[model samples]
Target: MWKFYLFLLPIFGVNISGLYAKNDQKIILATYTYDTKDRIENLLPFADLLKSRFEGKFEIETKSFPSVDELILAMLKKEVDLVFISTAGFLSYIDQADEFEIAGTLMVDQESESTYRSIIAASKLSGINSWEDVKSKSKGLKISLVNENSTSGYLLPYLHFQQRGLTPFKDNFGLVEFTGNHKKSLDSILTGEFDLAAFGENDLQNLSGNEDLIHILWVSPAIPLGPVMVRKDMDKSISEVVEQNLLNLHQSYPAILESIKAGWIEAQNASHFEKLTKDFYIDFLK
Candidate 1:
């Protein structure tokens, strides 16, 4: 769904035919608002910050996409100027180097690690206690995942299962469902709708009150956090402005940063991605 953000100050009228011929005149800030709570908690503030930074120079609007492909397609069509996407989604566009560029990577906390893990959690009622039990006994159990494009929810778990000689959705599980987001997947597991679910470890932190109900079967090795990506054809000056605004966001907007887990830091480009792209898969796929 598309949500129009209203600015506190009046937006100056700029002729669309001149400086913004390609991007439909407005700079679209496309991000994945998978969790409903985040739409209010994290996204609203983040969008407000962008609007404040760009002001009248660029008419900025925020929109959410259902999947990674749609998000990338929006960039290809010049409908979206920037995207906040996952690491797995970013990797899918790495070969098309001329089209997309990394704006910056999201850092979750003061640690600024730029990394996270995939957590496999199961209900105690499911009788699955350990990773070995999951390997031997997941058949006929209802399973849930965020989505195919999710790094912790699906991608990392897929790679983990493959390494153990298991085919995730095809392995005759009672139900293999995509709940669209980690919160939903974890909730389903907690409510008895799913025997097991895979999601980001951060999502698990929210379920701290229900410790007696679920068991974390496994946690995958650390993986790089996703980066904010932008189209290459955007105005160079606009790109620089957006980049500088984000790098210094934490100091200016600590509350906003804390709302979204943490603030962002400069990304190390392709070399930083080597661990996720080359090492992570090579160790498993091979």
Candidate 2:
């Protein structure tokens, strides 16, 4: 698995302060999307930012993956050079030991604060108040989840249930459904079409005035927002250039930061992902 961050990461490599190397190759930059035009639009300017700094040497690209595995397949096929990917999507590709390294992490601000989080919520009508309630009543309640690729929407929530020996998949739940995205998942639960839903904390926050319609059952630990990823063998000069630009974006290029409501931070202090990664491989992925 990729270390995914660092002063230097234990498993991933970083060279922000190291000596540089120049490669003639034009660095490829891309972001993963779930067939959303909005996500494609958000990704469009990223290459422009790099191009401005690199004197027009970036190949702007975007890949739309219906699922996380497709993105991993693209990486395995060497079809991408750098990509913006969720923590779950990145770490789930366990065979990617040396092919890539985390170049940076996204932050909602200049500091380490990242608000990427998961929530397990119940319809007010569901009679489910907590994990214990869900466990005891798992057999008959319908549950909605965003697809498997989602970190805040699926992965962490899935692992949370798994840890307590309550596999929603095998518990004879009334219906286990993938709502495709967070908003739909919220919508399903809000209307009482589904008794439970798992999705991002921000999704509920974005849907104001609906608090009375839903009961909050659980919230996950802050998931590190997605990171910037690059090939491990990328030219040192290019890597340093990208890292420096990432570190400076909040200042030198505020619009880019604002576009995504997040800024790039140094690839440092990601030991938090270690346990998450380990548990995923040892427990969830199995």
Best candidate, TM-score? 2
What's the number of clashes in each of the models?
0, 4
lDDT of 1 at 271: 19
Off by over 4 Å in 1: 1-25, 35-55, 95-98, 108-116, 191-193, 253-286
Q: Over the full model, what C-alpha lDDT does candidate 2 score relative to the true structure? A: 0.65
User: What are the root-mean-square deviations of the candidates from the true structure over C-alphas?
Assistant: 7.7, 7.7
The CA lDDT of each predicted structure is: 0.64, 0.65
- The residue-by-residue lDDT of candidate 2 on 51-71, one tens digit each, is 555444444455555555776
TM-score of 1: 0.71
Estimate the TM-score of every prediction: 0.71, 0.77
Leading candidate by lDDT: 2
* Deviation from truth (RMSD, Å), model 2: 7.7
**Candidate 1 C-alpha lDDT tens digits along 99-209:** 767776554343335336788889888888876887677676888998887778898887777777767466647779999887888888788778999988776766778
